[model samples]
Target chain A: MAFQLVLPDSKSVSQAPSPLAYAVDRTFFYAAAAGALAIILLVIYILWEIGGQALPAIGRSGASVLVNTQWDVQNSSFGILPQIWGTLYSSLMALLIGGFIGVSIAIFLTQDFLPHSLATVFRTLIEMLAAIPSVVFGLWGIFVVIPFVRPAADWLHDAAGFIPFFSTSLSGPGMLPAVIVLSIMILPTVAAISQDAIGLVPYKIKEAAYGLGATRWEAILKVILPTASGGISSALVLGFGRALGETMALAMLIGNANQISLSLFSPATTLAALLASNFPEAGAIERQALMYAALVLLAITLVVNVAGTLILLWTSRKMAKA
Target chain B: MTNASVLEKPTATAGAAIDCNIDKIYYGKFLAVRDSNIAIEKGKITGFIGPSGCGKSTVLRSLNRMNDLIKGFKLEGNVHFHGQEIYDKGVDPVVVRRHIGMVFQQPNPFSMSIFDNVAFGLKLNRFKGDVEERVQHALTRAALWDEVKDKLKASGLSLSGGQQQRLCIARAVATQPSVLLMDEPCSALDPIATRRVEELMLELKNDYTIALVTHNMQQARRVADITAFFSVDISQGGRTGHLVEVGPTDQIFDAPQEKLTKQYIGGEFS
Candidate 1:
């Protein structure tokens, strides 16, 4: 026998849910999204207000503020060229010294020359160094590095005083200490990241090298290092960025001088050190000028970060194709 | 078992060839390969076939001292390559490996161009004369030149699986080693690629001694002039691999002396 079937109404099926419930769900989602948008907009607005107030000071002060030698805030005069030079010069010196030591340590740790247990111990020590705060490093630098470096600075002043770089008076805390402190500060960052990069090189490739009769050093130089070049570059950039923006440590050792000197032992100031030293007591105009310094710092960091991102993207693309 | 005991001693006929008598142990305790013996002809294809954990690969690796990479691995017997003990204290593994190249189970081409990968070994050994010509010659010998000649600058990874394996083979052979060890070189390839590799191997044996470790018995039967079969015994607390038989491929398949060999060859034990 054939059975008859019944069909439900399409209108009731379509209208099963209450519109209020839908409205409540939609409202919650929109509210959460709007809250996130508000936070972002608030941050952007604050930055814009600060940046707008600071940029005009540079224009009012003119190219002298950017390229002049003196930074006398008392006479309504301000120049950051010396400070900029100090910052770049010290950071570059730090990078060169720190980068060499850090990459060497990384290679030693990752290579087969050392015993496994010793390598582990060395790696652990480096990681611990990274955990020490910048303030602690500053204190250590003042107490320990100053005495040892004072003699060297004096020697440079006496022996090589004919050279502009070595013409400093060699009294106390200065570019030499600042550069040394910055180097020690950035050491852990470079070493740890470089070791991590070297470790990321696949074992299979090294084995392939060995299978082809490559010596331990040959395998590392030809196969492992090239494969890890991108990561190592990123590590170096990270160290550079850290050195560029370091504040408390540099301030403690940089002597707070705005005069640029060619000598490693001479007194000089960096932007962060300058900001830290005088930001609390600065008047409205002085504060705006300091903010302009901050703005310059921000621009420099932004450029560095953008460059790092581009490098990372290009390397990843190359790796993917490889 | 009686025949295995007799085969433990080197054949008097192989007076001038390389003999690898590998007794592998793991952790300084567990015996992996027990009294295994094989004589490698100077320029011929010899295939080793066994089930998983049969220690065929261990014996293959012992020839070039590849087993030295493993921690706590020890060997009791000697592997003599051209009458010189490979395990001697002064014998450098690097120099040994330079004269004896290897291809792995997987196609592990470097992340460089096809030309560069082939040129890697030569450069590592500091081959100073006409590198381009040597690289081209190696590529042609490995049967990869025609396919990759136009794209030598392309990354080795960009090639198909077969092409990559051939590229690896080219890289290995470019060093002009006397012996070429292949650890299941065609296992990761398709049937067509496998056939191409097999043909290449046959062609290569004329110039270099070839030792192959494979699980595919048919591949062993097709390409190997001599075949060695290994089996595992677990009663010894650790897996003990022993060479059950070694002979010409036809004799081993048609008239195996032992019942176990017959069972394995007739496909009775799945």
Candidate 2:
């Protein structure tokens, strides 16, 4: 395309549309709408392809394909229950731990308690933490984090052994290790989004708090946090999404066990991990089982993402009212 | 200008509400305000009139130690509330702020219910009386209760600009502090709303001492007992604001001692 020199000549013509120009403009409008429609078609096509491939496995067991735990490759029986449990609980653990740490870091950095120059430096460091490759975190977890978590896991087992969640004994890579590494991996993502959300709160609101004789802690807790809650939650949603789909990091540390365990110390596998590990070696039925698991993961992600968006909208409406 | 013109006539210690002996305020090394002195009188309105960036708002903020939040903000001064120095060692800014409340130029209502907004200061101070009655009393005193009595639970932001300002006034007044600092409180309001606020200020003077910073000369003439005019002094490094004249409202407006104050009030220059 060449740059053309043209000035807007106000005197040349009226803004009223000509017949030919109107037809051309109408075509352009339809063209743009079709471009948007292409995305919807693409999503539907992928879903159809996946559904067709997995239908045989789904038809054989019906709902048991989701609930059954048996995976006998010799007899060709499979279930996604353990992987589902692993994915859900591990992602929840990651969200709780990572969301807490992310929000705390965001609050600390955004508060006026620190000098502006120093806050800027700390914020930059956290962003850099977010940019580190996931495989490196998984590797670091293998060498450094696994050792640290072992003693903590043992102590947890001893102190709360009566509890089902803390009953298992740890040897190496497991659910807890995977959860911790995932949490750390998502921390900066959460922090970065939360920083933006907290930063979006108007300065005048904080001033209002201080003007009413509020301490810095009071102002932040009572005013700034509530005002930024919508954005903060969106940050959490992004973190949750990232944790749900993360493959290399969780796959490396999850120990790739196919059985479900209530204990944090027990080894586990996730949907992404199962797909990564088994897809290369699987026969038709096993491959179908993995596809079914991926379908379930996709469904869960959609439900969760919709719920998060609704919650965010609810908070924003409340903000508008208040 | 004469010394008395630069600094207000010294009121008795017992009668002064808040007094400032400010050497300078600085952002890093750049001075914002220099050599300022003023004594606000008890149960009366003292008005600060000046052009923009003349440190009038800075002085208003300094009264409650609100400037402490700004990075690189350094002040060489002592602010006394009644007889005790507010910036003295062991005097917490939080506690100092509780004794003196401020209203901003913008009507910044907390993002909560109107009832909660009125109750914010009372709860902060741990008011040991009937909370509901106190909120009602404060709102009534701010002249917003009659309009918003039924919808107390409505969000503070749902109110009009003027009503929000009144809500803020009610919030500040709920603490029942000795001094009320208003920094152009009516600047964001409509003319009718501004009149209402001005009227409310006159009524409030019966119970509270007010130090007002305003851009409106007519507002000062109508409501202030003492008027202090500030002007920017431009020199080599930067412009520094300092008090140019201080006297009774009529004298300051009718016979401004400094040429700059005359230029300002006479509309010859800002």
Top model by DockQ, which number? Answer: 2
Instruction: Report the poorest 10 consecutive residues by lDDT, candidate 1 chain B.
Output: B1-10
The reply for model 1, stretches above 4 Å from the true place, is A1-46, A58-64, A114-118, A156-169, A313-322, B1-17, B27-29, B268-270
Report the TM-score for the A-chain of model 1: 0.82
- By DockQ thresholds, what CAPRI class is model 2? medium
Cα misplacement distance, residue B172 of candidate 1 (Å): 1.2
lDDT tens digits by residue: candidate 2, A1-322 = 2233455765654345567877898999999999999999998998998888888878887788788786677888888888888888898899999999999999999886577799899989888977889899899989988998899899989999889889888879898889999998789888988888788777888888987878888999988998898889888987897788888888899898888888888899888898888899999888887778888888888777787678767766765554
> Model 2, range B1-270, lDDT digits (tens) per residue?
232121123335787888888899998888999888999999999999999888888888898888887878888988877666767666677776777888888988887899999898888877789989999999999999999999999889988999999999999998788789999999988999999999999999999999999998899999999999998877666889888888899999999898998899889877
Q: Estimate each model's TM-score.
A: 0.86, 0.89
User: On residues A1-322, what C-alpha lDDT tens digit does candidate 1 reach at each position?
Assistant: 2233446654443333467777888999999999999999996887798788897687788566788777678886877888889888998899999988998899999886688999999889887887888888888878888888888778878888999878876667888888888997888888998888788776767778999988888888889888888877877888888888999988998888778778887778998998999889999888888888888877776677667667667766766554
Off by over 4 Å in 2: A1-42, A309-322, B1-12, B235-237
Clashing pairs in 1: A165-A262, A165-A263
CA shift of B79, model 2, Å: 1.9
What's the TM for model 2? 0.89
Clashes by residue pair, model 2: none
TM-score: which candidate is best? Answer: 2
Q: Rate the local accuracy (lDDT) of all candidates.
A: 0.83, 0.86
